[model samples]
Target: MRLAMGFALITLFCSNSYADGYKLHPGTPTFQGKHFDIDIQEHCQEGEVTCPDVSYDSINKKTGARLHLKGRVMFNPNNYNFQGYIFDNGDYSYVLNPNHSKGTESVQIWNLNVFYKDKVIAFDEGIMQ
Candidate 1:
């Protein structure tokens, strides 16, 4: 009985560790523009995103206070495909995909944004107007 109990506890602990290994630091900043918050994620060349290099910030629109986190992504002129997420304090999240794909006729780019209030509002692909 003692051995069985010990084994069970060990198994439980090990499984939990492997369940979800990725952790985002809780240092997310807050923005005060109409009382809003924003989150941004950008993907560049591999092995480029690093701490004190790939972070976000909150800018006060009225006061023009640039409160931001320092972060940077690897740059490759040949490759233009990138993907990431942005969470806005207005209860919304955005998925940003800035890429240009060569095609037979024309190139294509995908951009999306989601807003949550009483319902979900989706912003689809389109030229910035």
Candidate 2:
């Protein structure tokens, strides 16, 4: 029983330690489509765990209107799922599936969901080094 428990603990530890945790850089990356032009910034802090801070400045390119949002994303290490919020409230949120972001030593490919009032307004994807 003790051996099994020890193995389980080690497995959990290794998963957390080895998994590629989120990192945000100083450069803001933007994603533009036919309707939206969105700039995203990840405010990654040293020793940050679970929730990483993020913000967005998005423009409806057609109308020249804008939306600026600030919040954090809660990441599930087990499945690579993420839940994000706008305005620091649960009332506004979006979910990002497995394909949103992928990280390696050299770069991170981010396909983030931009949310406003429980709706996904835009998708911002780019490479950050």
Q: Residue-pair clashes per candidate, as listed?
A: 4, 0
What lDDT does model 1 reach? 0.42
Candidate 2 C-alpha error for residue 42, in Å = 1.5
Deviation in Å, model 1, residue 68 alpha carbon: 12
- Give the best candidate by lDDT: 2
Candidate 2, RMSD to the unseen true structure? 19.5
> Taking the tens digit of each residue's C-alpha lDDT, what string does model 2 give over 10-34?
9887765543231122344355334
Instruction: List the global CA lDDT of all models.
Output: 0.42, 0.53
Q: Residues 80-128, candidate 1: write the lDDT tens digits.
A: 3334334444454433334345222343343445557635575444321
Cα deviation in Å at residue 79, candidate 1?
A: 17
Best by TM-score: 2
